[model samples]
Target: MAKYELNTKEQHFATTRLEAEAIVTEAKEDKHLIMHKIAEKHNKYGEYFLVDLTFSYNTPKEIMGVE
Candidate 1:
């Protein structure tokens, strides 16, 4: 089995790097968010690589100053 980690401030997990990349791409394109960073990482766990993503956008809540 393979595991990957994704982060957009919060964290998500994927089974493959491609899947994680897809998640970030779709969010930026479809959802119109700004992608700050996209990367792949490998740790001591072995052959599996983790995908990391960072993005940002202004939400209606932020504009409205909701708390």
Candidate 2:
């Protein structure tokens, strides 16, 4: 069986490629969020394989004002 792993600040795993892709697509829809697919690898653990997908993004910062 092959598993797909999506990495950002945290890790997410999906059993199918479509599921993995869906996660990325949803993330992209956020207008304030910037995301990139940094790396991808296959056959991570021999028989227990994985398609590892790594992503990089900017974390949103909030500004505060004091009167």
Considering every candidate listed, which one attains the maximal lDDT?
A: 1
lDDT of 2 by residue, 1-67 (tens): 5333323543456556666677677766755344434233457553221333345433223112211
- lDDT for every model? 0.53, 0.46
lDDT of 2: 0.46
State the lDDT of candidate 1 residue by residue for 3-58, as single tens digits.
32322453455667777777676666745344434445566774443444454555
Q: Cα-based RMSD of the predictions, in order?
A: 10.1, 10.9
- Estimated TM-score for each candidate: 0.40, 0.40
